[model samples]
Every structure is written in structure tokens, then in C-alpha cells.
Target: MIATLVIGLREGLEATLIVGIIAAFLRRNRAPLTPMWTGVGVAVALSIAVGFGLQLVEQALPQAEQEGMETVIGAVAVAFVTGMVVWMRTHARTLSRDLQASASAALGRGTAWALAGMAFLAVLKEGFETAVFLLATFQASTDTGTAALGAVIGIAVAVLIGYGIYTGGVRLDLGRFFTVTGVFLVFVAGGLVLTALRHAHEAGWLVIGQQRTVDLGWLAPNGSVRGALVTGVLGIPADPRVVEVLGWVLYVVPVLAVALWPRAWRPSPERVPRVRAVLAAALAATAVVLAVAVPSGGGADLPRTVAVTGDARSVTASVDGDAAVLRVSGRGREDQITLPASVHRRVARAGTGADQWQVTEDVPATDRPTSLTLDQLVGLFGRVPVGVSPSTNPGPFAADWTVRDTVTLTTVRSGVLEATRSERNVLTLRGGGLPAARTTTLDRDVWTVPPADADRAATDLAAAQTRAAELRLWNAWLPLALLVAAAAQAALAARDRRRVRTPTTTTPGTDPSRGPPADVPARSLDHAVR
Candidate 1:
């Protein structure tokens, strides 16, 4: 909730400031505010719809797909927040000035809608980023309801603050406020990095460095207040894998350092090449590490085939992409049936063939019947082949025999199709010398792949995994790359500060005691409200 509240407060106030500026400009020009408000209302509604729609789509996906979607959303949220933070740090001082300049141009166009559209776009951009970031944070939170309420309250508070600033009823160091919030957001984004890395593994996007190296259970006991703050708010898991810690450290340390780095008043020409060289070297090292470190997994073993054979019949099946093809053989002929592949969460893709297919689903009655039935062949003075059939009733003898057939068709995680067929029969023997009933059963399972197509699919999947691993590795190393740049900035700041303290000769037209120029525009708040 605290994380979300800060996110909401910072984002909401930014939007509020924009709207306030636009409203004040219109009021000064004696232009009505209806069109601008209309645009803002539409943008807000669209942003809300986008957020809800994304959540709904995520919920409707399969487990693996859901994890994949979550990884994407979390990563995107982190990127948006990071970019916003960096951009705001540089632009906050000039924001009011820039908005006024744009507003003036819009009014000169002789249409209030132009300004309205500007307002709409400004709010919409912020709204979209807010929605995505909040969704990611909410998913990380243990109590989503509380998080959401906090966001609402934060936005409410931001509105009051924005109104106060506009009305000259509040006085604040806007520069200081943004700086503090910017630092806080950096930590939040760092946590999101950890969260995204964890999701990437669950989604099967990254496979290397999965060993659990840290145990934070003592620090974050479940259901404890500390746990809620540490795990939920901070986005740290009780037990994190090696990659997770690597990602968190690589992101947090360098990003925080850069965020807190002292600003330099002037650029140092001699140091530029040195800074570039350090960054280039870091990137090159990261590339070399990735090339050698990321593993190219050997192809996984194909699932073993299982078949049940009787005196005159047998059953087996193979995987064909998203579908399953079952083959049943009898006497001198073989028949095939195609069905959709069923996926079970508990089943292991690369396991002993014997242990596979522990759970099987019965073929539904809706399946189309085959041309020939085993019971018909049995009735022709042939040995009774009491084995599994695709259909419950497959021949005339089925009327005299009670047949129960259960079949399972599925595609395993390792890109293999597995099918199991089980059947039981009880036929009434009405002959003078025969017993009252005859009972027989057959069970079979098959795990196979077409030599060409299935192999290609597996290769493609492996290639995708490799690429994703490389991308994730590079992503984790990006912070170290940023550290190079930060180091240069710190060095420059130290040099400049030391020189200033040495009381060097002052330039003719410059005033050293004036310090840095103020960031806020004088007319920003004063002209925004009545």
C-alpha cells in the first residue's frame, strides 16, 4: 500500500499540475473549460478501460501464459517508471515553461480544441503509465484491496495539494518534493526488477542460474508485519534464486547511485572520452560474459511410447503439433484417430515412460465412430479382441457387451504428446457350454513425435528460450553499465566542488555566490488558478 500510495501521489500530482496549467491559461484567455474537461474525461475513461481489459485478458489465459503475460507487464511497468523518473528529473524545472509555450501556440491556432487535445494527451500519457505501474505493484502486493484504496487516497490527496498550489494557499519546495519522490521510485523500480526476473523463470523464458542462494525467511516470516513490508511492499521473495539477487543488486545499486549522484554545474571536456570508454568497456564485458555464460541446452528426450496388445489388437498414439493422433491395429489393418491435446499441470514432460499417463480422461461420447469395430471382427469366429476403442460402442457386438473406454491425449511441457487408452468389456455368453459372461481389459499409452515437424517445433522453442535468456542477462547487466556513467558524473562533481572551494579567480560576468538557478517558474502556480 505504501508503494502504491507513493506511486499514485507522484503520478497524480504530475497530471494535476498539467491540467491546472491548462485551466489557468484558458481562464486568462477567457476561453471556456468545457472542451478541455471533456477531453480529460474521455482520456481517463480510456485509461481505466485499458487497465481492466488487460487484467481480464490475463485471468483468462492458461497458467503458463498468465505467467508470461505478468512478466511482460511487470517489465513494461518498470521501464515506463524508469523513463518517467529520468525524464522528470531533467524536465521538472522547465515543465511549466514548456507547457505555457505549447499552450500559447495552441491558442494562436484559433481553436480551443487544439489546447483541449494537448491536455487530453498529457493526462492520457500519465494515466496509462500510472495504470500499468499500479497494476504491477498491486500484483506484487499481498492485499490488493488495501493497495487500491491507498492509491485512491493518494490521488485524492494529490488533487488537494495541486489545488492548494494553484490557489496560492500552499507553499512547497516542488524541486525538493520531486527529488525525494524520484529517489523512492528508484527503489520501487528496483524491486520490480526482482519481481520480473522471478516471473521470467516461471514463464519458461529464462532457465539458467536458478539455484536458490539466499534464505530470507528469518527476516520475513509469513503473516508477520515485517514480511508484509519486506516481501509485499519491497517485492522481495522469502527465498530468491541466484538470478533474482543478481538482478536486484545490478539494478538497485547503480540506479540509486546515479539518482543520488551530485550534479555538475559544467561539463568537463577532457572527461567525456574517459566516461564513454568506461561505459563501452562495461558493455563489451557484459556481452562477452553472456556469450560464454548462457547455456545452450541439449535437446530434451522424446517421451517413450507405450502400447497394450491383445490376441488380435493393440493401441498407440503420437503427438502432431497441437493435436494427438491415435493408432489402433488389429489383424492386418491399422486405424487412426485425431483429437485435441490435453495438458495436465501435474504431469512431467521428461519422465520415465512407465510413470507417465497416471491420469487419463475418457474419450467423450461425441467423437465420431470408426468404420470398423473390433467386436464385429470378434463375432466372425475370430478371437475376441477386448481392447480399448475410440468410441464406447464400435460394433454390433457392443450391444451384447458393456464397453467402457477411457482415453487421455495431452502435450507435455517438453513439446511431446502423450496419449493413454484404457478399456474394459463384459460380454454375455449365451452359448449352451459357455459361462454367463466374459470379461477382458486393455490399457495402452503412447508418446511419440513426427520426425520432422515435432523436432522443428522443439528446436524453435529452444531457440526462443536461448534468445530470452540472453535478453534477460543483458537486462540484468544494464545497471552495471549505468554505473560507469554515474562514476564519471561523480568524478566530475567532485572535481568541480573542490575547485569552487579553492576560491579560484571569478569570471568577469559571473556571480559564484548566486549558486544554481531556481527550477520552478514564477508564474506556474500563480497563473494556474483564480
Candidate 2:
């Protein structure tokens, strides 16, 4: 919820500022509002198309491939966001004028296509950025409702702000606004960078060498809200590594230096308000350092866990090093679990996002352990909680008590509390200071699975597969679409070039070359226009 709001506010502000600047220019120049509104419509349409296209393509991706797509897109987003931040910092003073000129030029061209192209590019930039943010959030959260709500609120706010600025209802200090927001943007961009790296790491584009810098869950559990807030925003690892630490530094230091270090904006010393604006901007400039400079992630908090079980009827079970469970029942095809993945095994994401055993020996179909190490046992110290029960609302399935040790897991399902020593055993085990909580459900932050009796889980699995297939199909189709779009763009560029060159048969002494080069290369445009 908090993340959605932050994204809404940040992206909303960017689009709002763009529309406001263009509208203000139009209203001042006495241009008919029709073209401007048409441009707005075009922008909106393009943004929607991009958004739907992304959703469509994403829907077809398999889980791991989806992850890969997100990682690559996120990395691209980070680069774009960072570049924009740096560019804005250097060119903020001239932004308003450039926007006005661009708007005016687009209008003078009087081609709806050109106008649409201009607006589409502007809004598409915002849309792509927003998409990246939303996708990153989606990977971390399971709440579609919250994300939808945030996007709606962001668009609504942008509309209001954009309209108000154009209609002259608000007098904003454009220069100061960019300066302050630009600094805040550094943090926002930094978050994007971190998020991108995380996705990339998961997708195998980056690697964290085998190392656990610290494990402090016993000292201070990291699942708390405060811990969550810090981790989500700052990219702090509960267990750090040498590479991740250095990677963060390599990204943030240069950006911080550029943001800070005093620079004069309005050299008009006579303008006191500009100085005040600078001071207001100073606050953000100074604070941006905290985005990356604060180093506090080196702490031991990666969950250390253990697994335990009690005696059961109709079944025999063994425990490994005070953690993990394995059970074998007569003729029942061995059922056992040495340790529950979490104190509560959450039902979402197919038990991912936490309910994971650091299975060292790789549990196979066989019931025998291959090898075990003391290090593995110590790691298991924080792997399980000492309790088990059917989550009151197990949905469709009856409560399953799975006994799994180093090798096999036999899970039993039951509906009600009819237990003699004969019913599937209610195994309870405890270690450490945690209260003896019951059940195999993992954290609530994860997506919930359907009850045991509920067929929804199967349906969800089917749906995920369907989406994965669709993503595969889209992957096959995207190259074709890009080809078409590229062809269109090239054709349009050529047409534009033709229209700009040689206004056809200039009279003697009236050199068409007298015109200033509209497409002048940035470095040179020596002589003045006629």
C-alpha cells in the first residue's frame, strides 16, 4: 500500500508537469485548444496501448521467463530513470522554454500525425516508466487492488494538476519545482536501480557469491513493519555480500555528487525569490544523499530455523539435528517432513516468498539422505517453527501434516478435531524465543492458496500455465510488432526529411540554404539564418 502510493505520487507528478507546461504555453499563445486537446488524446491513447501491450505480453510468459522479462525491463527502466535525473539536473533551468517551443513547433506543423507523434513520445515515456515501477511492485506484492487504486489515483491527480496549471488556477514556481522534485527523484531512481538489480539477480544476470554476511533474526526479526519499510525502500539486504554492497555504492555515489555540490541556477542576483527557491531546493539536494549514503544493512537477520516432531501412530518419523522431519507410514507411500518451511506455510505463489527449505542434499523421490554437513544443520536452526495445525481456513484441502526430514515428505490431510493417537499426528516442536505458533502456513505477505477442499488452487495453477503460454506466444509476436513499428518510424522520418528539404525551385538570390538548419547536428550550426 505504501509503495503504491509513493509510485503514484512520483510518476503522477511527472505527467502532470508535462501537461501543465504545454497547456500554459498554448493558453498564452492564443492557439486554439483543439490541437492541444487532440495531442492529449493521442498521448493518452498511446500510453494505454503500451500498457495493454505490456500486460498482454506479460500474461504469456512462464514463471521463470516472466521473471527474466521483468528483470531486463527493470534494468532498462533504471538506466532511463537515472539518465533523466542527471539530464534534468543539468538542464532544468531551460526546461519550460524548451517545452513551450516544442509545443509550438508541433502546433505549427499542423499535422495531426506529427502532433500525435509528439504527444505519444512524451506520454509514452511516462507510461513506460510507470509500467516498470508497477511491475517491480507487483513482483514484491500480491495485491492487485492496491496497485489498481494507486494507478487510478495517480491519473486522476495528474489530470487535475495538469488542467489547473493550464487554466491558470495555480501559480507554480516551475524552476523550484523541478529542482526539489529532481532531488527526490534521485531517491526514486535509486530505488528503481536497486529493484532492477534484484530482478536481474533472480534472473541470473547478476550473481551473489556464496556468502551470508550476517544472520540476526534472533537479535531483531526483520519481518516487522519498520524493517519492511527500510528494506523495501533502501534495498538493504538482511544478509549482505561483498558484491551487493559494492554494486550499490557504484550506482549511487556519482548520482549523489551531481545532485549536491552547490550550483547557481538564477544568476540574476537581483531576484531574491530565486535564492529562496534555491534554499528550498537545498533541502532536497542535501537529503538525497541519504538515499544511498546511509549504510545500515550489515546485520544478522536472515531467518535461522529448526524442525521437530513428536511420536505418531500408523507412522514412524525421525528428526535431523533438532531441525527437519521425515515420516514413513505402512503401505501409504512414505510421508514425512523434518521441518515446515515456515511457522505458517502461506498459500500464495505456490509457497514461495518464504516457505523454502534450504534443501542441501536435494530431496529426491528416494527416502534416504545422501549426505549432511554440520553447516547445513546450523543453517537449519532457523528453518522451522515448533508447531503444526490446519489453518482454520485451509480453504479446500483438509489440514495436511507433512513430515519431511533430509529426504522425504509424507503429508496427511484431516478435516475436524477427531484425534485419538490413531489420527494423523499433531506434531509440535519448538526452539528459540518464538511463541509456539501452530500450522504450516507461511507469511501473510505472500499470496494465499485455495483451501484444501477448494479447487481454486488447481484453477490458479492452470491459469498461470495459460498465461505462461500466452507470454510465449507474445514473445514470438513482439518481434513482428517491433518490425512494423520500426518500419513506420523510418518511413515517417524519410517523409519528414523530404518535406524539410528544398521548398522546390527557389529564385536566384533567394537561397533556400539561407534557412537555418532545422536538423542541425548538436555540435555545429555555424552561420545565422536569413
Candidate 3:
């Protein structure tokens, strides 16, 4: 939502400024307003149509193609915003003058259509920029309604501010305003650059640098509010990729430095200093050293296992780490428990009586079960053995069971059962036409660790192999270079600010009728359009 709001505010203000300048120019020249307004309307309609067309294209594409499209769109938005920020910073002080000059030229042509075309082109540029930015932000957001609402509010506020300025209700330092906003927009554009790189990776255009730089999953789960704000507004995911962080740093640092640097700091060919040259070389060396020292880490590929127990009435369990599977079968009834390694207690009961068939004692035990009493054995084997109640006739006693543990270990057993241990294991019961019975002795064994899954093991190998191949020196050094440039710019700005300047003085008795003189200020025309 905040992302969209910034987009609307920035773009809307640009459009409003253009319209205000054009309107003011036309009213001063006694030209018709209808044509300019019509052009603005048409440009607005075209921008909306283009936005919808992009959305349609995205929706119609396959997943891979959709990712590719998002990458392209994100790239375009970053470029547009970067260009806008730079252009505004360079031209803001003279913006009103330039717009008025252009308006005069268009009106002097004596063609209403020319004025309309000029307004159309001017507004279309800003409108289309807004459209693309909003589209990119919407793609990144989880709540479209909130994003849209924020954008609307931003635009409305921009309009109000523009009106206030035009009507003399408000005053602004346009140069400072553009400078500060340009700095902010540069960061926003950097976020878009990172977003684009991520999309490109998803589309498989780029295969290197898959390692995560940081994992914030524990602190901000994917769908949490804090996660959404970070990812959607700031473009930083909980788990960020190495390339994503590099891209952000590389793009933002230099761009922000350039935007924020004072104009007086700009180097003149005649004034290049030896100290500045030395600083540049030092910064480059530092970046090179840092780049060479940084190491790339490998990706993670953990193994998982699935365990199944029993037949007919079965229990299936899936676990990642250390675990055990316990199955109890007797009569026609069966029960299973997929216990974690931490579990150390067991409870059960027996009998045809409803109250008799209940869990009796459940006490914590430090060791795995190796022996059981008659009552405990009855509960472990199952409550209703042979599926017979006290009211029903009994069947001949018979029971068959098997417990197998596989993956990281393999273990198998048959007939009378006892306690067993394994990382991933399962127990099954067959032929359960039995009467209630108690066992006194049972056998148990520990499982041996087995080899990891072949596929996952292969993936881990590949990830290791790619570690060095994925290392890009530029990714590590670019931010350092930008930081150095920012420092240099700051030093230059400081020097320029401290230098004294002589003010030019007009000769006392110069002719007052010399066409108002070159230094005379132009009459303020802003009020005409307001």
C-alpha cells in the first residue's frame, strides 16, 4: 500500500505540474482550454487501456512466461523511475520556464490541434509511467484493494497540493522538493531492480547465485503482517537471495548519492583536484580487495521421509528428523502412534467393557520400552483383541504382525512384537482373528543409519559445485564503489560551499528604459491558470 501511494504521489504531481503550467500559459495567451483538456482526457484513457492490456497479457501466459513478463515489466518500471528522478533533478529549477516556452511555441503555431498534441504527449508520459509503476507494485502486493486505495488517496492529495500551489494557497521550494523526492525514488527504483532480478531467476534466465544471504523465516513467516510490509513495501523478502541483496546495494547507493549531492559539487574540467583522483583510486582498490575476499555459500537440500503402519486400517506418517512409528494390533482393531524422538511415555487399556478399554497409566519414562507387565502388554497389543466383546462369542486366537523401518536405516520383524527404535520406521498387522492374550517376552533392536536419498544427495553435490561458479566480483564491489563516489561528492560539495564569491554590481545611473534590462525578473504568470 505504501509503495503504491508513493507511485501515485510522485507521478500525479508531475502530471499536475505539467497541466498547471500549460493551462497558465494558455490562459495568459487568451487560448481555448477545451483542446488541452481533451488531450489530457485522451491520454488518461490510453494509459488505463495500456495498464489493462498488460494485465491481460500476464493472465494469459503460462507460469514460466508469466515470470518472464513480470521480470520485463519490473525492469521497465525501474528504468522509467530512474529516468524520471534524474530528469526532474536536472530540470526542476527551470521547469516552469521550459513549460511556458513550449506552450508559447505551440500556441503561436495558430493550430488548436498542436496545443492538444503537446498536452497529450506531456500528460501521456507521466500517466504511462504511473500505470507501469502501479502494475509492478500490484504484482508484488497481496492486497490489491488496499494498494489501489492508497494510490487513489495519494493522487487526490497530489491534486489538492497542486491546486493549492496554483491558487496561491500554498508555497513550495520546488528545487528542494524534487531533490528529496528524487533520493527516495532512487531507493524505490533499486527495490524494483531487485524484484526484477528475482523474477528473472524464477524464469530460469539466470541460474547462478541461488544461495540465500539471510533467513528471517523464524521472525517473519511468509504471510505475516510484518513480512508483507517488508516484502511488498520495501521489496525485501524474509529469506533474500545473494543476488537480490547485491542488486539492491549496487543500484541504490550510487543513484541516491548522485541524487542527493549538491549541484555545486559537480566537477568542472578545469578544477579537477589531485586529492580527488587519489581518493578515487583508493576506493577502487578497496572494492577490488573486498570482492576478492568475499566467499559464496552453497544452497541447502535436506532429506525427508514418510512412514506407513498397518493394513486395512492403516496409519501413515511423514517426518523430517528423528522419529519412531508404533503400531498395536489385536482382534479386528488396530491403533498407531507416530512418535517423535522426544516422546518417552505410553498408555493403554483392554477389555469388552467400555470402561475397561481405556488408557490406564501414562507416566514419563527416560528409556524406550523393553519389557511390559500383563496389564501394560494387553494395552500395547490392543484393547479388543479378535474384535470380540463380552456379549459376543469368541473366535480362535491368532495374530500376525510386522514392523519395518526404512530410509537412513532398515529393520524388519515378524510375529510377537517388542520395543524397537529407528529414525524412520513403520509397523504392519495382518491376520487379526484373535482372543485377548498377554505376552511376557519380546525382542527389540536398534536401527542402523542408512544412506541419504539419492536425488537429494545429488542436488547437494550440484549446489556445492556451483558455489564458486556463481561468485560475481562485481556484485560484491559495486556498493563499495558507490559509497566512495558518495564520499567524493560530499567533499566536493563542502569545498564549493566554503569558497567565497564576488557579487556583480550594477552601475548607478544606467539607462532605466533599456528594455527592462537582462537581469529584470519576468512577471509571475502562475496566477493566470490558478
Among the numbered candidates, top lDDT falls to 1
- Give me the overall lDDT of model 2: 0.47
Cα lDDT tens digits, model 3, 325-362, are 54534348755645554532222211001010111122
lDDT of 1 by residue, 37-71 (tens): 98899888988888899999999999988888888
Against the true structure, candidate 1 reaches a TM-score of 0.60
How many residue pairs clash in all the candidates, one count each?
A: 0, 50, 4
TM-score of each predicted structure versus truth: 0.60, 0.46, 0.57
Query: Candidate 3 regions off by >4 Å?
Result: 217-228, 269-464, 472-530
- Which candidate model has the greater TM-score, 1 or 3? 1
The residue-by-residue lDDT of candidate 2 on 1-530, one tens digit each, is 55555566556666666655655545555555566567667766776676667767877988667767777766665576676667766655554545656766887886544544565577678767777666666555445676667667866765675555545565455445555555655564555555665666676665433234566354334667655554554445456544444445656675766666467543342343344445445434433443334442321212112122233223333323324443434343545445544432312332112122223232232432233232332343334323322233121222223333232222212111011111212222232222442343221111111144223433444454444433432333333433444455455555545555636786677654343222221001111100
| Structural RMSD, model 1 | 11.9
Q: Judged by TM-score, which candidate is best?
A: 1
After superposing candidate 1, which stretches have Cα over 4 Å from the reference? 265-274, 289-530
